[model samples]
Target: MMPASSATLHVVATPIGNLGDLSPRAQEVLRTVAAICAEDTRHTGQLLSQFGIATPLLALHDHNEEAIAGRLVARLLAGESLALVSDAGTPLVSDPGFRLVRAARAAGVRVSPVPGACAAIAALSVAGLPSDRFVFEGFLPAKAAARRERLQRLAGETGTLVFYESSHRIADSLADMVQAFGAARPAVVARELTKLFETVLDGDLEALLAAVQADGNQRKGEFVVMVQGAGDDEDAKVAEGRRLYARLNEHLPPSTAAKLAADLSGAPRKALYGG
Candidate 1:
């Protein structure tokens, strides 16, 4: 434990899949920190054992982060330098530790980042899609209806769309994406990233759905799905407008739904009404 004035919180990134991807700095930080707060103690304990880093492990996950964050911050304030890590990849990227990090920062304790392999960044690097400006919608709703609603809201986004999905729902998610974004929208599915059996599948949304359905292996691992942004073409706008109109028509009159969809999708009112 360091002095109170010198104590800090190190937010370290662990390997997403390939253990070799863990950086020396991350390993060093984990080895030296008074204790490492992990999303899963048993899982992280194995990782620590692989590197022979015997620092203490503390369980800090979504279920308990809020309740324990204050206590962790108090320990930092009392001069115990600590580290935070998730089960995989960076902390707080669709993982736990948001409360702990915020608590430490608000307590005036220093918080540092040790960045490494992130599935989103890794997938983006090779997806060949626009990455300069993109949105990371980590995991969509698990249910089909809620998931479809979310996709519909993002239908008009002009930047790349990235998502993390589980193996169980990958097929259904891709199907909903096809319905919302159109079958021809270009997309890529990076599965089992950084690990053996890693595969990156790319094509239109329809093709992606078909591929995943045809190949059972494609739906068996963690996935990072990237979709091309909505284009500025007239056809694209009109297509988006039709999707919006259909959804809005459920809650509003046809004329009102068409007007609102036209306004939101930037398609002509006549186009929405098929004039």
Candidate 2:
């Protein structure tokens, strides 16, 4: 049983893929939270069914967070303990629990975290990419042009770059990644981690793209793409920039080289061929 003093909001993390990763403490909180604000009740229901947790769940997804935020706030203020759980992984890491979390905090309610499995961290675990400093670009823009623009902006960032891509757009996303991040940039596509049919393909963008293209089997499952950061070596950096310039110049003007080069180099736009 959770402590009486712990009658507070708990942001719990459930299993990312494998149910076994769910922590005892997290489960304890889950079983005892007076109520739970789930991104999707049906989805959370399946999870709760595993542990026989019968706590009532409130659906508080993107579309409904604002509508339900006030009631949730009032409940928490009345000293009713609640747990917030996403369909999977840590709550609020790309989920809709932020408003409630913020409201709880604003109301001077104690908020505790029951941390556990996180998809980004799960993918990063075996991605073989640098873990030092990474950025999570959660689920790219659905539109190709917007997605490509976003990809182009992060091409040569000097830290591991992580992106969540869906199966339907994975091919197109990978293709844009090749254009921006480059064909030779080292990357890893981790999917279904800790679940059946788990696959991790680590290779340069071109090879990974080709591998994904060649096999119908490789195209399934949720994905996390981890790209290695830019390396040192002034000339090598320029070469990477030249590659991007080559692609851009084909469909753009010479003046466009600076923008393309900047995207492929961590260097300043002005420094890259002096703008």
Please list all clashing residue pairs in model 1, or write none if there are none: none
Residues 1-275, model 2: lDDT tens digits = 33323359999998878999988898888888789999889999998999999999888899988888889878877778999999888888877788888877777778888888888998898888899999998899999988977876676577888988888888889998887766888999998778899999999999999999999878898888998876656534654565566457668776677686667664455544543
Clashing residue pairs for model 2:
none
Best candidate according to lDDT: 1
Off by over 4 Å in 2: 1-6, 233-275
TM-score list, all predictions: 0.92, 0.86
TM-score for candidate 2, please give it: 0.86
lDDT of 1 by residue, 1-275 (tens): 43344798999999989999999999999988899999999999999999999999999998999999999989889888999999999999999989998888777889999999899999999999989899999999988888988898888788999999999999999999887887998999999999999999999999999999999999898999999988777757876897798799899998999999999988888866753
lDDT of 2 at 33: 75
Instruction: Report lDDT (Cα) of residue 50, candidate 1.
Output: 98
lDDT of 1: 0.91
List the candidate 1 regions with Cα displacement exceeding 4 Å: 1-4, 233-236, 252-275
Candidate 1 vs. true structure, TM-score = 0.92
lDDT for each of the candidates?
0.91, 0.82
